[model samples]
Target chain A: AQSVTQLDSQVPVFEEAPVELRCNYSSSVSVYLFWYVQYPNQGLQLLLKYLSGSTLVESINGFEAEFNKSQTSFHLRKPSVHISDTAEYFCAVTLYNQGGKLIFGQGTELSVKP
Target chain B: DVKVTQSSRYLVKRTGEKVFLECVQDMDHENMFWYRQDPGLGLRLIYFSYDVKMKEKGDIPEGYSVSREKKERFSLILESASTNQTSMYLCASSLTGTLNTEAFFGQGTRLTVV
Candidate 1:
């Protein structure tokens, strides 16, 4: 069985400040990593994903995450954030041959203050 | 673009009643999923269907049933609705054989059991 752990339940930051959301996973085999975001009263949208080569993956909305094989971590980061970036972020993992079953973390609530 | 649509956005049901949540995808996806979302718990997979007439139980399948008679449609059923089942139900779909592909999600259905 594979599982994801998001250390932060809520993070409060001011506008233009940098933010980091920590995520760790436990799996015996190689797994694919993903980050997803959900706005208020809406379904989730994919932020980024790490499949194979590049250790670092980025999203168009100034969000990026790096996959660390040694530490079993895939942390999401943003250099600068706006008020519009306030949402719930989730880290997910799926094994290579698991038939597309994505296991998600508890989630992190990013609250950006103006 | 893939479009996943849920039957209802908001539903109010009485306790001990039978509840059915419908999901439909238009992109001819090979995978469909049903998940429940809470404030702290990001998203927990309840059931998934890989192909027509093929369904699989996920992490949390207790008290829940699913039907996938068609390729584009998946239905989640609550045998006896309870207050604990009052949460946001999300439907998602993804392509088959893609390791890094992101799943497209519907708007979600907020079910309130009173």
Candidate 2:
């Protein structure tokens, strides 16, 4: 069985500050990693994904994540976060051949204060 | 952009009522999923469909049933709603392939069973 672990349950950061949300997974097989964001009342949206090719994957909204195979980690980072970035983020994983059975972490609540 | 539309944004139902939650994806995705979102628990899969009339039980499918009469629409049903099932429900759609494609999600439906 595969599982995802998000290190932080909640992180409070000031506006324009750098932020890193740590995530680690336990899986013996190769897996695809994803970062999803859920706004106040919206559903979870894909922020970034690491399928193959580069170990680093980035979302257009200035968020990026790196896949560390040896460490079994895929941490999301942002150079500077805005107040609008305050939301709950989830880390998820799906096996290579499993289609889309995503196993998710407990989620991290990132609060950006202006 | 992939548009995954959930039928309802919020719903309040009495316990023991038959509840139906609907989802539709416009991207002709081969896979659609239903997940329950609770605080601290992240998202747990309830059911998923790979094709029309084909379904599979997910992590927590005990009290949920799904219907996929069409490729673009997936429905989640609760034969008898319970207070424990009162939480946010999410729907997602993804293409089926070996590359492990990313999923697109709807804006979520918040269901409260009293």
Separate DockQ for every predicted complex? 0.61, 0.78
Model 1 chain A scores worst on lDDT over the 10 consecutive residues at: A93-102
Quote each prediction's TM-score: 0.97, 0.97
Best by DockQ: 2
By summed lDDT, the worst window of 10 consecutive residues in model 2 chain A runs over A94-103
Which tens-of-lDDT digit does each residue in A1-114 have in candidate 2?
999999999999999999999999999898999999998988888899998999998999999999999999999999999999999999999999666689999999999998
Off by over 4 Å in 2: none
| Off by more than 4 A, model 1 | none
Q: Write the per-residue lDDT of candidate 1 for residues A1-114, one digit (tens) a residue.
A: 788999999999999999999999999989999999999888889899999999999999999999999999999999999999999999999777444478999999999999
Report clash pairs, candidate 2.
none
Give fnat, all candidates.
0.47, 0.73
